[model samples]
Target: MKKFTYENITHAKELNIYLEQGNRVLGALGYTDHSGKHTAKVAMTAGKLLKKLGYDDHTVELARIAGYMHDLGNSINRASHAQTGALMAFQFLRSWGAPLEDIAIIISAIGQHDESNGTAVDPVSAALILADKSDVRRSRVRNTVPETFDKHDRVNYAALSSTLHVDVQKRIITLEVELDEGICFLMDYFEIFLQRLLMYKRAAEVLGLRFKMKANGSKIS
Candidate 1:
């Protein structure tokens, strides 16, 4: 078993600052789950899923890195933040002496992470899509106090819990959300997330798997 390590010094400290600053900015804008914990979870999940699918270590690491830094563009603005994030990541990685090809992959992945602004340009993009979409849940909003809970947050907050499981042998990727109907119903949740879920299905197709969503013990898809 080989461990992955990058020679970049800035990744250790500067990435921390980016994550912190992103959290502060999103908190101000009433968005939840753009913080360290969220990004870390996404990174780990993306890497593990790719690794389980038998991708090379470099690919998995790229997926992890892309997942971690995907939301940094939100620091500047919500719209087209993915493109801004890609440029930011490209400059930082280049400064730290990361290879240009790898930097390109990372930047492309970051730039296309948003469903509205993104497309699956590579396997990394597919992995990132799975990781990002799997993060919808109630616990994500447990700490942040939004001024007005919109459909996005309300459906997410209504989830009592959620789990994303990738079954390698079965070629199955399941997103299960335990819901509390007092806050929002399944319809409301689907109304907000259905499109993203479709994107997740396409992402899963790229990974040769099925994307299944189970809400309150019922299979919705």
Candidate 2:
């Protein structure tokens, strides 16, 4: 069995085109940037989440690999991107000579990252869930024309900065954000992200941690 590291997959060069094309597919549908920026953020955060909690190096690398490829299925269709993305990653990793055991973890993490049809299924999946959902920022809004922005776009655009921090010692994971209330109220954040927070709480629990949220300076969840 061969071992493939995150650095190897990220530097492959050939995979860059697929990630870019996947972003194009979402862009055509008026979605936020799910391209390199979003995927890279998820990959880094997922790997860090596991590493901070003392997961094995190989498992941490697997999380990063899964995070990077999670959105590729959006290239084919967004409706079932998680499921499709998992299959796509499986093929790519298998062809690249990744161990079948490692591929199993990566594909499972990719397949279950979406909130609509997925939950925290394991440590890696939970980490991916928390990491993917934590990335909310104004830069992710691809809809430049504010006049045409929807609730999702407006809320995301209102987020000036967002950070997900893990306090492993305290067994807590907190998502802190600074939002421009003039553009969108705190209520707007909850309106769109309440379900996400609930899901996040569940994910954190899987890692033996409590999930928290702070908007501006107040803890809301």
TM-scores, all candidates, are 0.89, 0.95
Quick one: best TM-score, which candidate? 2
**RMSD per model, one decimal:** 3.2, 1.6
Candidate 2 — which residues are off by over 4 angstroms?
1-3
**Model 1 poorest ten-residue lDDT run:** 1-10
Write the residue-wise lDDT of candidate 2 on 1-221 in tens digits.
24477877877676777888889988899988987889889999999999999999888988898888888888789899999989988889889998889889888988988888888888988989989998999999999899989999999999999898899899999999999998999999999988788889889998999988899999887
lDDT of 1 by residue, 1-221 (tens): 02224323215677678767877888787777677778878788888889989999999988988888888887788888889889888877777677788888889989888888566667898888888877877767744554578877888888777777788889998888888898888889888877788788888888888988898999977
Candidate 2 at 148: error in angstroms? 1.6
Candidate 1 regions with alpha-carbon error over 4 angstroms: 1-11, 142-148
lDDT of each: 0.80, 0.88
Clashes of each: 0, 0
